[model samples]
Structures are given as structure tokens and as C-alpha cells.
Target: MSTHVLFIHGLWIHASAWRPWQDLFEERGYSTSAPGWPGDLETVAATRANPEGLNDVGISQICHHYADIIEGWDEKPLVVGHSFGGLIAQELIANDLVAAAVAIDPAPVKGVKVLPFSQLKSGLPVLGNPANKSRTVALTPKQFKYAFGNAITDEESDALHAAWTIPGPGRPLFEDATANFVRNSPAAVDTHTAVRGPLLLTSGTEDHTVPRSVTLAVAKLYADNTASVTEYHEYEGKGHSLTLDAGWTDVAEDVLAWLAAQGFAPAGAQGAAAAG
Candidate 1:
């Protein structure tokens, strides 16, 4: 049997963000986990009311959280992540804790160059606030609208805001410490090169937070790691909200197909196999 699948989430979001992916994998009979970032509230309502809870969520804490989940798995699971979670996935890979990984629009890791104006603009609030480094920071409605919901319509965007927007730890957003300081730490990458596991990176053509250039730059980092092989995909008109918007299911299906190709599933999974 293939290894289980584990998903790590990014800032301002919780494991619930992976619900669509979880549903798909569950249908395919694969065990899955969507462990929370430290202090992650289970629901959107709660998160809105308690943004400060996110303050305690730091890179080290979140990394250890995923590490615990990985330890409990029977085998080294295939790890996938988006945004800040992508950075976390790299950390686990460096530690030799995963069989495969997919980093979807990962945040800026140590040494990745070519920051996009949109990315810096999206992060301006946190970067502008000195206290953000050690606290939880919630986005103002305007800030949230631009950074995350610009591609979608106002109504749908408003709903998304109501449903998933929350304050998150700001440390990782501005984390400039050693790479090994947390997951994807610079030290870890240097000492633990050559993951030899399959790595996939998907970027949205219209993504602003992680522009096409930066995404490619990040891919080069993993390629630099001496990973046995790496795959890349770009979805047209897809934004930072690639996994939550209209075409999410197709994207999930594509990921499912890729996993099956990597032998993450049975041969029959190539067709209309049940969701794992």
C-alpha cells in the first residue's frame, strides 16, 4: 500500500482549508491528516472572535505539530502544503520525514529570491507592524480583500472572508532566522540535501501573493536539494485561492492523478476510483 497523505496549512488558515482534498483522498481509501497550526481554532466563527489565539503559533511550534503527526503515521506519508504550509512541508522533507511532497504556492523560504510586489504588498500589514513578529495579526477587511480575494467577486469574496478569514501568527511571515531554525530551516537544507523523494510544485498563473516568478524560484530551491525528481504545474487564471475557488475539484483530481502516478494509489485509481 502507498503511504498515507498529510497536509500542512499556511498562515491565517486552519486544517479545515484542506477539506476538499481530504474528501478526495478519503474516497480513494487513503488515510489522511490535516493537523492544525498551534492555536488554530476549529471553525471560522471562533477564529474571528479570538484572533489573538494565533499569536502563540510560530514556525517551530507548527513544525513540531506536523512532526508529531508524521511520527504517528505507520509510514513516511506524502506531505503537501500551500503558502506558509509549503514552507512547513519543506522542513519535514529535510528531516527525511515524508515519502513525497507538493508545495503549492509556498511562502518565501530562506534564500529564495525574486519577491513579487504583490507578495510584499500582501504582507505589508504584518511587515509594517513591528509587534507582528511575536503576535497574532488579523487583516483588515480591505487588506484581506486585496491580499486574498481580489480575483473572486465581492459577494463570494465576502463569504470567504466570513468563513475562513482569521488572524494568524505573523512571525513566520517575517521569519528571517536560520532555515533550520524551523521547518525548511537553512541549516536543515544544507545538511539534509538529497531528499530523493518526488516533489511537485503547482503555481497559479494569476496568483499575486506568490507570483509565477517566485514560484519558479522556489521550485529551483527544491531542485537544488538534489531531490530525485521534481514536477511542476501551472493553472491558468487560478489565483492564490486556487484550492478554494471554482476549479478546486479539478485541481484536487489532478493531484490525485499525480499521486497515483507516483504509486500513491492502486492501479485502478487512475480512472474513476473512489475518493480516498
Candidate 2:
């Protein structure tokens, strides 16, 4: 059976943010899809222009939306996600919906114990205002730099912000921040599942939004699930923008390698299948 890949983007970015990733995976003979969140606009400009439309979106709604998409797929897909999308990927895996899953700097799911000051600072743009819980929030370039581009140059950070940044729902951020304290939080994941397929969690060393500590905490949750495979990788000096930054291909190649090792893709194949 052909390996189908589902690419999910995180907040403060539109679905177009995964275009490069989709292209790279397709070159490796994988069919890929990047489905937008509910109320997501086609472009950053349109999204920024109508930010309020995303106001009421929460983690549960977004998770169910992607779940529906995954359910409709012709083949069980290899799910890959970044930040908030990463958490969604874990949720899907927990529900036994995906063949395998990769989460890159995933947002802290319920029970993640390490909450760095930097992470709180990065989230302050939305969490600072309780009113924002039901509103859309757009990150300023400065906030984006602190959260995602801290490891890159100023010029590159500015360029990336201009190209990929967009408004995202504040409710999900609030939901994640308070998930540990809330009963039956939407951000909770079933890490103890025996039926979940191979899972990989990648962390960027310099990431402030979802720091190494947070990813490590998340990795620990799956430690007892010996029935399935769980792996963790850390990229030094990389930030949350690792997937979209100048060296994004490095991370993509690493993920491709991992997928091959886990038997999700054909062994030893570097690019597309040969022409008939």
C-alpha cells in the first residue's frame, strides 16, 4: 500500500506553511495533504484581514475537525504536525487513527510538568488577556521572534514573520495553558494506549514556545507503552520555527529517515518512484 502523509500546521500560521514540507515528502514518493483548521483562510493576508473569524475556535473543535478528515482518508496516513498540530497528532494516535505520528515542538498536552518562563512569555500574547480566550490573537513580529525565530537572524526572522505569520484562535492557547488544572481538559492525550503506532517527538533546543523540557516531559508519558514504539530527537540551536526556517530541509530529511526506519515508507528510496 502507498504511504499517505498528512501535514498539520500550528497556530500563527496558515496551511500554506506546510507547502515546502508537502513538496519534500511528495518528492520522496509520498502522497501528502495539508488540511486547514476550521475558519482558516487560504492566505496570510486574508487571515490577518479577518482574524475575528478564528475567535471561538478551541482545541476540541480543531481536534475533531482533523479527526473527521483522517477518518475519510482512503488509507491510514502517517500524521505529522507542528506545535498545536503536534498535540493534535498525538490525540489522533491515542485514538488509534493514524498509522504513525511525528510531533515537532508540540504544544504541552495535559500533564506536561515543565513550564519554563520562556514558554509562558511566548504565550503571553494570547494568555495575557483572559478576554482573549474567546477571541483571535495575532502575534507581533517581536513576539514571533521571541517564540519561534529566536535562533535565527533578524532579517530571516522578519522575512519569515511577513511570509508565514497569521492570526490564530486564542482559545486553544488558553486551553493548553490551563489544561493541567482543568478537569477533562481538551488538551489531554492518552499516552498509555497499547494500540498507538510508532510515535516520534522532535524538539528544537532553542524553542521557547515548546521548550526541550516540555518535549522531554511529553516523551516520558509514552515510556510505559512497550507495546508500541516511541522516540525522541532534539535538534541543537534550532527554534520553534525549525520546520520553516532556512535549514528546514535538515529536519524534514531527519523525519523522512525516521519514517523509513519505522517502515512507514519504502526502504532506501530517496525520491519519487520511477516512471513506468
Candidate 3:
């Protein structure tokens, strides 16, 4: 009775980014997968080398791609996503495809307001540029440091910059922030409503990209509606790079702990996996 878990990465990152997470979850006996974004595995490296190819993919296409992955799972798994991936997790739950979910520093969905200055600045790359209406946007070193790597060390941030920083889809972000998001296509951003499953939201205190308020704001919508348990956690001194940063294991441990508390782990949960 092993419950499978699916991990979805956010914008500009490839599924391979979840490799470390996969190892951690697998050790706990929960099966896992991080499906590639449409054309991501195929073109991310090349796109980063040139950055021009990112224009080929858009929000609609990426959402469809993730939806296909969710549909193919043997069973609805505990969905965990970061940034844009978090939006997809909620989209799946709304459609009744997920058993539970954990959204880490998730990007705000359609209808979710932007109240924090940090969030506005984090979104400037996409929302601020009119050209982003139909194009991809790459973050400069300064932008990345300000928006995503503020909490990590200089050395780690440098490595992150070298290996993972790349152009992200402009259309999906623009659509989430601008285009009517209540539709059923892509991520179900427009008109998307409160979910019906257990949800655990984790926010980094230093996460300028998705502040504590934004994370809790999403949880509030689900608090009174869903019978599902809803919880929010804030990890102090952590930044937007919570998953890949030095303290990622602590975050992972927190997720494991929360899932155990919810009775959401698979029946065979052992060692780090067992709530008992």
C-alpha cells in the first residue's frame, strides 16, 4: 500500500532538479516522480545556452503536459510542487486528481492578490515587461539574487547561478498574473477555487518570491471549505531556494512530518516515513 508521490518543479527548471528529492523520498519508501515540463528536458540546456528557444513553449502547452503526467499516475499521489509547480498541484486537486498536496513558496494563482512588495519585485521580470506578453524572460544575476537566492550563501548561490538559472516561460506567468485564469486549460488558474484534499503549505521567511502572507493567504481560502486538514509552516532564515538550499533536508523532514500527521503517507511507511 505504498502511496506514490509526484514532484513538480517550477518555472525555468527541469524535472532533473528533483533528483535529490527523489532520493530522499525513496529512502522513506514512498515512490516518486518529477515529470519533465513540455520540451523542457528536450530544450532547457540548449535554451540556457542560447535562451532563444524558450519562446517555443507557452503556458497552455506546459499545463497540458503536466496534466498528462497526473493522468498517467497509477494512483493519486501526495503532490509537492514549488513556485509554478505549486499552482499545478492545486489545479490537479481541484479536478480531483490528487490525494494531498504540499506547495512550497508557490506562485499565486489567478484571483490571488499581490499584497507584498517582495512578490511584486519578484514578478517584475514577467509582469513588468510588456514584451513579456508574448516572450520568455531571463533573470539577470541581480534579479536572481534579489528574488530567489537572497537567503542562500554566496558560494551556493554562485553554484546555483552557474548550473540552474535559465529563462522561464513568460506566457504562463503573465497569464497567472494577467490573462483571465478561471479557465480549465493549462493550470486552471482563472476561476480556480478552494481544493478538496489535505494541503500543507511551507513558506520561507526570506522567500521574497512568495512571502509568508502569500502562502497563508492561499491556505485561508481552503480553511473553512474543505473538510481536508490545512496547515501552514514558515521556516525562518530560509530563502526562495528552500528546496535546493543547504537546509532542504530540514524542509523535506517537515513535509514528511506533516504528511505523517495527516495519515497521508502510504500504508508501509517506515523509518522516516512512518508517523507512528
- Top lDDT hit: 2
Comparing candidate 1 with candidate 3, which one achieves the higher TM-score? 1
Top-TM-score structure, candidate number: 2
Q: Estimate each model's TM-score.
A: 0.88, 0.96, 0.87
Poorest 10 consecutive residues by lDDT, candidate 3: 184-193
Report RMSD for candidate 1: 3.2
- Residue 224's C-alpha lDDT in candidate 3? 62
Predictions: Cα RMSD each: 3.2, 2.3, 3.0
Candidate 2 per-residue C-alpha lDDT over 1-276 given as tens digits, one digit per residue, 9 for 90 to 100: 438889889999888989999998888878899988998887889988988778789999998999898877777789999999999999988888899999999998898988899999999999998998898888888999999999999889989999999888999999998899999999999887667788999999999999999999999988988888999999999999999999899899899989988877754363433332
C-alpha lDDT of candidate 3 relative to the true structure: 0.74
For candidate 2, which ten residues in a row score worst on lDDT?
267-276
Query: What's model 2's lDDT at 5?
Result: 89
Which residue pairs overlap in candidate 3's backbone? 181-189, 181-190, 182-190, 182-191
